[model samples]
Target chain A: MTTNGGADLTRLIEPDRVHRSVYTDDAIFAREMEAIFQRAWVYVGHESQVKQPGDYCTALLGQQPLIMVRHSDGAVYVLYNRCAHRGALLCAKSRGNTGGAFGCSYHSWQYRTDGTLESIPLPAGYEGTRFSPGAADYNLKRAARVESYRGFVFASLSPSGPALAEFLGEARIALDNMCDRAPAGEVEIVPTCFRFIQHSNWKIFMENQLDALHPYVTHESTGRAAAELERQMMARKQKPPLEYHYLSAFTTPFNEWDKLQTVNYPYGHCMLQGYMGLRPRDPDTLAYEAVMREHYGAERTERILGVNIHHVLIYPGLSVQPALQQLRAARPLAPNRTLTEIWHFRLKGAPEAIYRRALAYYNLINSPSTMVNADDLENFWRCHQGLAADGGDWVSFHRNAGQDDEHDGVIASRRGTSEAPMRNQFRAWKQYLSSSEH
Target chain B: MPVVIKKRSRKKAITPKKNSFAQFRVSDDDVILREVEQFLYRQAELLDAKRWSDYIELFDADGIYWMPASLEQITGDGMPSIFYEDRNLMTMRMKRIAHPHAWSQTPAWGTSHIVSNVTLEKVDSRTGDVSVRSRFHMMEFRRDASRHFAGVYHHELRKTKHGYTIRLQRTDMVNGEAPFDYVLLAWV
Candidate 1:
């Protein structure tokens, strides 16, 4: 679309570069909402969000507000929130038990949990009219497809998407790694979430999710302070407290981040290997591992436990960390305004202390209250604001580009600290953007 | 922290006695009820005026400040939570705000606590610990804007050698999961 004549679509988004307007322009963002967000398989909600027969929660896919609800027959449905009678928006609350039917407060038009029109407030109103109940337009519209992968829900507004699993490809590992880590091969949603608005383009945050390089730089001061305290405690020759690692991990030298490899898969999905060294020999962790071993056999259990992914990105939307049970979805509002949902999870049938460990990471690092998250938000806002001014044209991504390694369509970094992740993402972007219209 | 109550005029006829929580032999006395009410009211006064450090000292070392993940997390065996903090964690949270990197704190939220319905729930005989419950309607203000938050506090207190020290403080925030207007850089 950016090209005029019979030029290459892929050239604009080559591995080494991307158009500046992807961040600084408004029109490109709208096209993205239509072509990418509306068409791609976007995550809807976790099964735990709507466990009961009639539980429902509101979610956003791009600019469209969609609701994910559980029907009476136990199937999940994704439906548009607009009411038929007077265009009243349904499901006013963020989340609640819909009680088997959705009733519009404006006209009181009732709909079944599955999104069919159950009844109108008055029967005689449409008696000799075109407003028939059986009409497809009269019923609440459902998304084109709703699919679940290991209890994680996804919806595609378009009728065609390669199916959720095929689209996921090897990125399926993200969810599999998440669920399989649980002793029972399942993880429950942390019902509540911490939602915050960032005054930046969504792409910046997505790129930063698995940057695999900025943590040691952006978080150096805070991490160094905490690491020093930990060093002092260690000098006394006693085991340092757990909180010390929280700060000291940021003190990882620049070269160490390079050692942590990043893998960018097709469809914009990518992964950053974990370096938190969270596998501690504490009693609580040992008890958790014992429960894990009890549920899964030794080899399979070892495989699941061996996975060390820090972040797994599912393309232009969600960033998932399976090990820590962290899921964050970015919804682009305006050219500059983006909203993110911060969700943590609990592995079912696991010890309470295990959940507490996840909670500590959530609160201390990811929570809005935490210093780590606060630092990220400030940079996000500042970057967006600075890009808005008439000072610059391009935001560079040419860091160690020529040195990337690729084989059989699977791109890997040469050095662990290479910029191959961004290049790989742009590779997928060009593929999507350059394809002939379906 | 900002408490939103004005000083009350001395009453001509305060209620004689009401057995809300502990039925101490002294609980039946009118003087004890009045004294207990005054204690809670004074604490509220200190909290409403941004005296956060002073309010935190009212808790014991082993105190817990909890805001449950969901209404069903009574036994702490469900999803992660709004907050499940011990005293040390709470102290660390406060310390982060004093730093320069907390963007939300750059222009910090100015919060006012509208506490009401103070009622003593029960009393223990062995250690003289008292349990109290209260409701709060808090209005968090930032950038000339305000958002309303309401919650109930379940306070478990112990009578120390000097004064009351809180063992547990659970604030059940209904709006905890709602997209926050700004990050809570300090205690509310």
Candidate 2:
């Protein structure tokens, strides 16, 4: 239950409670960055993000900076964003096309889009020296492995884990549903994003995504206001706009949320089912359904639309709401600080109205300026600040502990409000950290 | 906050109605311009003074309050916007913030919206509608943290016997592209 320095990592997590130090200790955060984030199948970027041959975007795996580039042969590459000459970072911007090769601004060392060394400033100066342009060390170092599933690319720092598809397992449905919504069977990344920094540990953000119990309490004010307006509209014999229900849905009673379920799998992949009633029988939706039925058969389209998933957590970093066409990635900067990038996508061949629906949800729920997000961010900061003090020793996960069902390594929570996702996460955390070869 | 003044890109043609307000002199009289400026200052005062009801009365029945996610964003119809509220939604926002259990506003936000650079942009003689552009710097403080938001405001005002009612109010923040510290839950 403890680490080498006498800090008990095992004691930090119990069946129903976790020690406060798991979230606040600097040593634990460092170990998590090295063992879990760096070694897991961490999502890098989408292939659509770099469609053009020379297009590139920057990402982070744990604390290490990485660049996801599209090579001339139309393959996506994940490489360390560093110069071979020194440790200076290459590609200072967040995203841009590098043309044919990346020329490091410091010392002018150049490399191809696939991280292969291209040229050096002076070949004669290194003639008698040990420096060789063709040396493997001179090329940009890539992550140990890189792979893609349905255009969502991921990379692992350590080479000894399961393949990306095997790692995703049941969670792969999240990405499939997102792409299947498009008639063309693809989706494109919207270039602009909302990047936000929450003053809390990254785990807080991840846990909140599937913690169905908190919305009713945390967003009560916003939900209540929307509910009031909805009532007024109903009284006036007018159907309230769908946007109002988006906020009012947070006021869903505990009994309703309890009827839902959380499916947990090995490697910490999990999903919370049907929190949002995305299948509204509206005119815009009807038109989009017709198109989907045309492209995919009626039966197939119905099955795809009936997946009933609300949110999927891809283990450590990514949280995807496939139905909403939005995905969020969390990157931990410190034990007390985390950065989240919220990106929304458009179904490639869906109607413009459907895209607009997703866009509205993006602005209303996911944007940093929304009441929904503001409420959650405040709690994250407050939780971190509270845990840092001596007031509380343990964070509880006792809601529906002994009630969960396990079969063939997959765990299913008996109730939606169960803290099974958090329990599953920590169980994976222990496995990743304890293993000598992650 | 650092001021970022990016050079306007040449890809999209600039709309003259949004840019040439100061270039052409409309109606040799300055009375309407002064009234527009006064109305704007009073709106800012009402918001800072927490007169939520009085502030809501300043808008027309069909007015919209919009803040686009980016300065380059031209339309709010299909694009992601930070704040896009009709009268009903705006009323809901007011009600939510005033609620006792609004946790984000536990220690209520103290905001000072400094309004300046009021300029008359356009006048629609047919509909008695006028457009004005101004700049704002809002300082918000809450729960031991303080932040400032600087932005340009574009207002479309409809004249009535009672005064001018807002048809549309759009805020384009200067630093809209950067990552925020937490959340922006107020009028930007």
TM-score of chain B of each: 0.74, 0.83
Residue B184 of model 2 has an lDDT of: 78
**How accurate locally, in lDDT, is each candidate?**
0.75, 0.87
For candidate 1, lDDT tens digit of each residue in B64-152? Answer: 77776556567433335566666555555555554455455555467677677766677666776778778888777765578787888
Candidate 2: what lDDT? 0.87
TM-score of 2: 0.93
Clashes of each: 5, 2
Alpha-carbon shift of residue A29 in model 2 (angstroms): 0.6
Instruction: Please write out the lDDT profile of model 2 over residues A1-438, one tens digit for every residue.
Output: 234542356667788888888898888899889889999999998888999999999998999999999999998999999999987898999999999999989888889999989998876787778887888899999999999999999999998999998999999999999999888898888877898999999999988989989988999999999999899889989788886778999889888988899999889889999766799999999999999999999999999899888899998999998998999999999999999999989899899988887887898888867878888999999999999999978999999998999998799999999999999988888788778433
Collision pairs in model 1:
A258-A416, A258-A417, B2-B48, B3-B48, B21-B121
Against the true chain A, what TM-score does chain A of candidate 1 give?
A: 0.94
Q: A7, model 1: CA deviation in Å?
A: 12
